[model samples]
Target: MSKIDIRTVNVVQYVCPLREGGSLPAIVKADDGFLYVLKFRGAGQGKKALIAEFIGGEIARAIGLKVPELVFMNLDDSFSKTEPDEEIQDLLKFSVGLNLGLHFLSSAITYDPLVSNVDAMTASKVVILDSLISNIDRTAKNTNLLNWNNELWVIDNGASFYFHHNWKTWENHLTRTFPLIKDHVLLQKATSLEKASEDIKQTLTANKITEIVSNIPEDWLISEADSMSPTDMRNAYIEFINAKLSMIDLLVKEAEDAR
Candidate 1:
C-alpha cells in the first residue's frame, strides 16, 4: 500500500551458526535487543541471496503470506574478533557492512505435511509466490516452511531468482516456466490457484514490486563480470517479476499438471 519501511540495526553479537545451509546464517543479537537469523553478505551465494530474500519476503507479505519480519543489519568489522571459530571469524570479517536478518521465530518447528495441514488459500498463495520468484528451495526435501505459533510462516527464500546468477542470459529465463513446481511441498494442497492468482494480481502492483526491489542495497548489485548499474539491476528484477506474473495462468497449469 505504501513504501515498505524496513528497520536497520547494528549486529551486537553472533550467537551460533545454522550450519546446515551453505550461507552459514547465524542467530545474532542486534542493538534492538532482538534475535535474528542473519544472512551475511559475504557468504557463498553472497548479496544476491540476500536480495532475493528481501524481494521474496516483501512479495510474500504483499500476497498476505506470513513471513518473518526482515530487517537490514549493519555488521561491524569489530564483531569478528569475538568469534573463536576462524571460519566464522573470516565470514564476519568479510561481511562487514549491510546484511539481512529475519526476526527469529523462537521455538518454531519445521512444517511437516503429515503433521500440519495447510489451508487451500494459504497453500495456493505459497505456490503462486514461489512460482513468481522462481524459488527452487521449497521442496519435499526442504520445505522451508515454518510453523510458528501455530501459523504457517515462509522462511529462507535466498535460493530464489536464480536467473540473477547469470545476468548475461537472465532474460532468457524471464518467460521460462518453473517445471520444478512438481516437487513443491504444497502442490496437492494448492487447490485454489486461480483465486490466489486473482488476489495477488490486485495487491502485487508494479509500483509495489518496484518499491520492494528498490530496497536492495546498491553495493549488492555490483559484480566484476556484470557491468549493469544498480538501477539497471533493480529494473531487471521488476521486469522479471512482472513477466512471471503475466504467466500466472501458465504457472497454474504447470502446478496442476505436476500433481
Candidate 2:
C-alpha cells in the first residue's frame, strides 16, 4: 500500500446517514481544517469496502483524475449501523468496520454527466476499463462523477469485478476488440492519457498481469463469489490495469494527430 497522510482525530461517535447506500456522514478533523462530516462506508460493509476505496481510488488517481484521499480509521462501530434481513442476518449481525475512510469532499454539490466533455473516444476508454474490470456499477444511476471547483472528481469503486468467475473469464474481459480505439480523448489534453494504451501494452504482458493480481488482499474476493479466489480476482484486475496502461500510447497518438 502506498503511504497516505491523513488526520484521524475528532472522531464523531455517531454517523449521520447519507442518501447513498453504504455510506454515512460524520464530522472529523483533518490536516486542512475541521470538516463537518466525512462520508464513510456503512459499518456493515466491512473492511473490503475500505480496501476497494483504497485500490480503486489509487488506480483512478494514477490515471490522472482527482480522487479524494482515503485513510484507515479507528472509530466506534456503533455509528450508522444497518440491520440485516432474514437471508443474510447471520453475516451482517457480527460485522465491525474500521474507521478506514476518505477525506471529506466539501464542494461536491451535484453530479452532472459531462457527455460532451466525455467525448466518444474518452467514453470508449472509460467503458473499456470498466468492462475489463467487470465494473458494473458505473451506470447512469451509479456514476460517481461529480463537479467540484469547476472540475470532475470520481468516487465509488466497491462494486467492480463482482462477475469475475475465473482467470480465463477474467482474461477475456480484457480482450475487447477496441472498436472505439481511435477516439481516445485523453490523447490530446492530458499527457498521462496520451498513448496510455500502447505504453501499457509494451510493458504489461499476461505474466505482469498475474503479478498484479497476486498482490490483492485475500479478503476482497468472497469465498462464495463466483467461486473466485482472491488470486483470481486480483489477476482479473491485473489484466484490466495492464490493458489500460497499454491504451495510453494510442490515446496520446490520437491526441497528437488531432492537434
Q: Give the whole-model CA lDDT for all candidates, comma-separated.
A: 0.92, 0.48
Give candidate 1 misplaced runs (Cα > 4 Å).
Answer: none
Candidate 1 C-alpha lDDT tens digits along 1-259:
7679999999988889998877899999999999999999999999999999999999999999999999999999897888889999999999999999999999999999888878999999999899999999998889999998889999989999999988888899988999988889999899999999999999999889988998888888987868778888999999999999999999999988887
Model 2 Cα displacement at 109 (Å)? 1.8
Worst 10 residues of 1 by lDDT: 222-231
TM-score of 1: 0.98
How well does candidate 1 score on lDDT at residue 118?
A: 87
Best by the lDDT measure: 1
